[model samples]
Target: FDLVELHRSNRATPPGIVLDPFAERALSPADRGGDRREPPDETSGATASRGGSGARHDRLVALDCSWETAERLVEDFAGVHRSLPFLVAGNPVSYGTPFRLNTVEAFAGALCILGERDSAERLLSKFTWGHTFLELNEEPLARYADCADSTEVLAVQDDYLAEE
Candidate 1:
């Protein structure tokens, strides 16, 4: 289900003992289509889960401090979305791109989180370090900022993922 649907059903509260506001906010109706929109009505399809229950939403969330955590999230997502096609792309641990899977083993083969247009924007929004961290990679930032389109920006994971 989408954000609007979640709030409508009042099932916006996802599973688990705790809730990450970012994740919760992700399901909020206003956040569904983009950063625009004024929330949703009470009975929109966007709020209905595939199961007609909130269980699928519950399973989507996982908090992990280890690789095991990552694996489980992927497993659950794959299990729930077996029918709907999705592109999984991220680091080397998850499956690489250009491949499809109906199980977690696909993750073992290669984990590739496809940075489609929206996903790419989400990544850039979450990963940027602002002006302070920018000092560490002034040259690259200066070079990349000159580009107009987001796709034109080269993403150097090392600069963002590496521990300072």
Candidate 2:
């Protein structure tokens, strides 16, 4: 599918962009920092409003669901936004977290959106927060090693570890 250029422009790429673990790139011992996912904080642009521009912040709907649920979201996005691109952001647990109130009908609705199924898959594939958590906890010594340079590591140890 030819990407809608405007929609493509509106995409908010996940902050910590990382290559898939099983992707073509060769794994290196230096994979720690590369795989860590940091929590989202206020963006620089958001903090720079010295004066009001009168532009309202867009609404973001956060939810938990599975692949089926994601498909439904795509449908809604396309239906509501036939021209403009809408951004959808969520962690993997947003889907299939049974404790939440989601419905199969909603999932089906998402799938009904033409071409949205692929978009949903791509969205899920690009989001790696869940994967980052797994790598960090499961391999304590190696997580974030990919991101830490020698100076940063020293600073971290001195500042954070010294008290411990």
Candidate 3:
């Protein structure tokens, strides 16, 4: 979890990870890219802004800050981007809402969709509400992870969206 320091603060990445304080690569917002509609090619580019084929441990960056500060934290990165697929937010601030995850929840969701369910759980375990988030989103997270391509992921998201 390479959390680039956008400001002077005391936040730290979770234990036992790459936890680099500054990462050179910048990522775009997950929802900004049509690029995610296609599978990520085997390189770091617009399509891989979210977790793509190129989303190796080194490439993964955690924008660990409040959503209010995320804009300054994530300025105009030159790339395509896309949001995490459909899932309810379980954090106390936005429980049961869609796309309202905190830093840990957001990273955990990305991990789950990228086929790292166990790892995602481990990440969320750092928080007290982690299990609640999983309880609310486990099914969709698994479903999104199983999707082979972004097109399929969007299709599944449509199904969940219809429920709203």
Q: What is the lDDT, from 0 to 100, of the residue 62 in candidate 2?
A: 23
Which ten residues in a row are the worst by lDDT in model 3? 12-21
| Candidate 2: segments with Cα more than 4 A from true spot | 1-96, 99-115, 129-164
Candidate 3 residue pairs in backbone clash: 30-82, 30-83, 31-82, 31-83, 33-81
Q: Is 1 or 3 the stronger prediction by lDDT? A: 3
lDDT for every model? 0.25, 0.24, 0.51
**TM-score to native of every candidate shown:** 0.21, 0.18, 0.61
In order of TM-score, best first, we have 3, 1, 2
Best by TM-score: 3
Worst 10 residues of 2 by lDDT: 78-87
lDDT of 2 by residue, 4-69 (tens): 111221123212111111123222222222232333321100011111222211111222335454
Candidate 3 regions exceeding 4 Å error are 1-58, 76-80
